[model samples]
Target chain A: MTNSEIMTIHQALFIVMALAVLGSAIFVVTTSNLFRAALMLILTFFGIAGLFVLLDIGLFAVAQVLIYIGAISILIIFAVMLTRGMQGMVPRNSQAVAAAVTAGIIFAVLLLLFGPFRVTVDVARWPVFSLFAGNASPRDVGGIAWTPPNQPIPAMPETYIADFGRSLVDGNQYLLPFLLIAFLVDVVLAGAIFIARQRRPAEIIEDRRRQAEEAAEEAEAMRQAGMTPDVAPLPEGAVASTAEH
Target chain B: MDLINDLLKIIGDFIAGIINSIFGFSPFLADLVTMGLAAVMLCTFAALSFMGLTYVERKVVARIQDRVGPNQAGPFGLLQPIADGIKMFTKEDTTPATADRWVYNLAPLVIAVFALTTYAVLPFAPGVVGTNLNVGVFYIIAMGSGSIVAIIMAGWGSNNKYALLGAFRTVAQLVGYEVPMLLNVLPVVMITGSLSLVDIINQQTTLNGNPGIPFIVFFPFSALVFLISGIAETGRSPFDLLEAESEIVAGFHVEYSGMKFALFFLGEYVNALAVAFVFSTLFLGGYAGPVLPPYIWLMLKAAVVFFIFMWLRGTLPRVRVDQMHNLNWKFFVPVSIVHLVVVMALMKLFVTSPALAQANGGVLVTPGAQAAILFVASLLILIGSLAVVARRARILRLQEAAVLEQRRAENIAAVSA
Candidate 1:
């Protein structure tokens, strides 16, 4: 494609992606059900990944997917189920509304401040087309582009080797923060445990009792129907050894 | 439209030229670049292979206790992990039957991904970083917390008592240590005056007349806090209640096996390596040492720290869960904050203050006199604090022993009656 045509395609992609991102973000905030909100948030992440792609940060796009879609989205859904707060009829909480409004105002302020300056879209006209041609995967573009000018682009072999060597000892630059983040992960883990432990014992007991009653009722209904109750196996080492037998 | 096209062409041509000129005409250069890209690809794929960590732990623990771990596998247990991998993949990957599958699956992957991705921003060698983010330090801290959600999910989703309990403990430990770790880093940041990893290293690159004052020596108390917190953060021995195998089993990864389990394992080792890497870089002056390639020195530094981790694992028993929390909240947190303040003040006085720099033989090549003075004062402070703590502890122990003796006498009297 000619440079102008490439530019147009890029611009179109960005606009579409941006709109999708905005729409998903809106849905994420506006959805009455927490589960649906979490789903919408996933969509928003995907949209942001697209924007990263548009910015020629393919590495970042993949990372966004690897971390957000692969990890964070799952986390949100897990949290929803654990609290069981996402269940039942959709109630629009005033707090959620306030949060949405606050977010909207901040977004509006940001747009007013930075939206006037146009983003340059010439990056699309680069030999990015060649990158996609001949079955060249998106993952290869980073290493081939690292060399000095006028060299033939190298073809990286398919080796799933991550470089942990240079990050530590590269004298000109250090990977201190990367290392520190690992510690931070530990700290965050500690904090999460502390918070989870704060749940009152009474609340826990009540929740368990309610769940047990529901299970017994389900089993009784199945017996009346002249059918074996299809129950999941009990976890190992528990008083509920009936499932094992 | 023509003018815009002309501008675009100029920019495009300039970029293309830069790319071409740098690469040269050699396919070898292309091969090298491809190799670099391949390394990143490996990291992504290796992230998937992180499940081996669990297998490794199982086997290692077994061997340590005079038993073969997973010996039933393909050969002296080499292919045991592979077998386990297949088992996990084929077995019904149930979502606790009633648990949150999305979060359940996502938690392991999240932990694995964040653990791996942090490597991207690290400078592997000079000019060899995956992404060289400007705010590398802050980004690491912010993104590091992203994994908390995943661990929480695992705990809540498993719908099992043990799983939930383990997850709760893991999260608490992770969060509690974060404050001290960040606070410990502040002094280094103060000395460097930038959160960029490159800038921090640059500040400490010299020995006699190199990068400046090794930030560690400049702020020894900060270094100690960073070291102490770093150890706590890794959940190593004396702090590793998270996965206390005898107690919590595998903790958050208790139910995980195969590739899923591997991700958690890899996350852990990678985390261990990453933590050691940071500790070495910040306090040991990164890759800066005499008579060695910078990268080699950096690795050696990290290796030393990693060995220390292993040594602690081997030598020290795990602290009780309550003690772990108390240590972080009661001791490390306050100490870290104070260290940051003290070091910041020191940096301001030494590096930034022109008069102080002049008195100490200039900023870059300051005499040992200033450092020696700071060292002596710190030594005195440390000794005083140690003395106070020892004295208090001795009195408390004596009082506790007396109380214990009284209780023993009461027990004997009851038995006689």
Candidate 2:
């Protein structure tokens, strides 16, 4: 394929993928039903993963699917199922205008930031992007064609995993930040668990008393209607003790 | 034997050749055709494996319980799966009146797709992998995790209370078990110094023509933990609480029928097969054997593992939900963390210290010393943990007895009054 043809094909693919992502994202926010919105959000995640694959970052693409679509989306749907009153359209208020203005300002800031860096961001540096341009020979793209003055560049390390691992743990690189982030995540997880633990003893007693009274009332109503109540009645003493507590 | 090892590659090349010949003018089209053919081949393999596995499971479980299983079809019921398939195809496809129709239909396909995709990175034999992914092990776990989403979808889309509860149990069980499963796998990755399953298998090969040392010998606790968590991940046997018939009436796919139900069934068996394949690859010296083809060896090991799964299913009763959660979060997770620490420490020591190597006449220079040290340390750790567990159990039992006594005293006082 010629360079221009390759570029056109890639551009077409990018446009389609970007459209899918943006469309689904908009749908996710606009959808009334929380369940459908969560599903739309999953589609947005998938489109983003596809874009990552297009960028030749297969690791991140897989991670995106694994972490976002697999874990987070499932959790979101589960929460939606657990909570009642989420099936209807979410009520909108004046805050929507404030949110839109904030989002627009952020978008403008991003554009302004990128405009200065556009000249320095050489697209050829990304071999996969260059492959779409039809200008990256296989050897050049994979570092197989390059050699240093003093040392031979080792046969392009088998897969990028090793390089990624080294970069993560190397002393001069991301090791400290990686460890810090890991610690932070652990702390956050522990805190969440502690906060969401079982209810206190007093709260449990209060809950039991309320449920017992409701059950008694339901049984009384059923008797007035000449029907037998199916619910197992709590012992009178037990209900009294719970209420006292 | 060598020919058998190369069989998949040969078939792949043959298909690619045919595609190239037809689309010679367009390389892109040729590549696309080749990929499509490979995908079809993998899907067919998954389907066939599912059929064969169902037959195997029934027969094996029946024999374990001393009953004749499905003997009315072709010789010894070899055609039973086929008959069942026809029945499934002919059955009415129904959706609940309140179901979210699109999501309901999408769930089964999602399950099947995720189940089949894990095979893409599995190394069946030498040079027979679909793709030698750098993050092959991680990719498998990631893809396998996708099924939880599908289960949740099935549960929610059905708009049934039981289905929703099943979906909740699925997220709790699968996600909880995944932690220890990944933790156990980390030691194997550290030992091999790579995340690729192909590299892991290669590292297990014999160095001087002796039989290869499987990872199970050195890390038996991890192996046990992996198998247990893997069974939970697949929702099999004692851990199959998600679909407990007595409690939830078939769980997430309760609303499905016909081929939609068939897809869920197929996905389950495929998942079992995938887990068995991974277990064999990780700890049982994948595709390594004497006087047999690599692929055959791989299949034989996987079959043995599958038989163990069946045996467990037939023998053990399903655990209660509280028991399952406690086993995973309280028992397996802590054990796995301690095991990871021991492995990392021993590995670092083995790599840095030269005294051990010199003592063993350079034999220790290889991973042998590291493995030996880890094996001994793991044994000690296992014993210690077992003691702790016993002590904890004792304390819980005493507490239970005390509570019972108090209740009895109160009952007596009330009757006397």
Off by over 4 Å in 2: A1-16, A85-103, A115-160, A199-245, B206-211, B352-364, B398-417
Q: Which pairs clash in the backbone of model 2?
A: none
Local error of candidate 1 at residue B117 (angstroms): 1.6
Q: Against the hidden true structure, what lDDT does model 1 obtain?
A: 0.63
- lDDT for B414 in candidate 2 is 100
Worst 10 residues of 1 chain B by lDDT: B1-10
- Number of clashes recorded per candidate: 48, 0
Q: Please, what are the lDDT tens digits per residue for candidate 2 over residues B274-353?
A: 99999999999899877887888999999999999999998999999988999988999998899899878776666523
The alpha-carbon deviation from the true structure for residue A157 of candidate 1, after best TM-score superposition, in angstroms, is 39
In candidate 1, stretches whose alpha carbon ends up further than 4 angstroms from where it belongs are A1-245, B1-94, B211-213, B246-249, B352-367, B377-386
Candidate 1 C-alpha lDDT tens digits along B1-417: 443324433543465455457786754454456546545664864454344544555665565667776877767677876776677677655455665576667778877667776676665444445555545665565455555655656765565556666666766777677677778787666555566677677667743453455666665666676676767665666777777788977676677655676566666777777777777777777756666556667768876777666556655788898878877786767655655555555544555445656776445325354465455544554565557667877998999999999999999999999
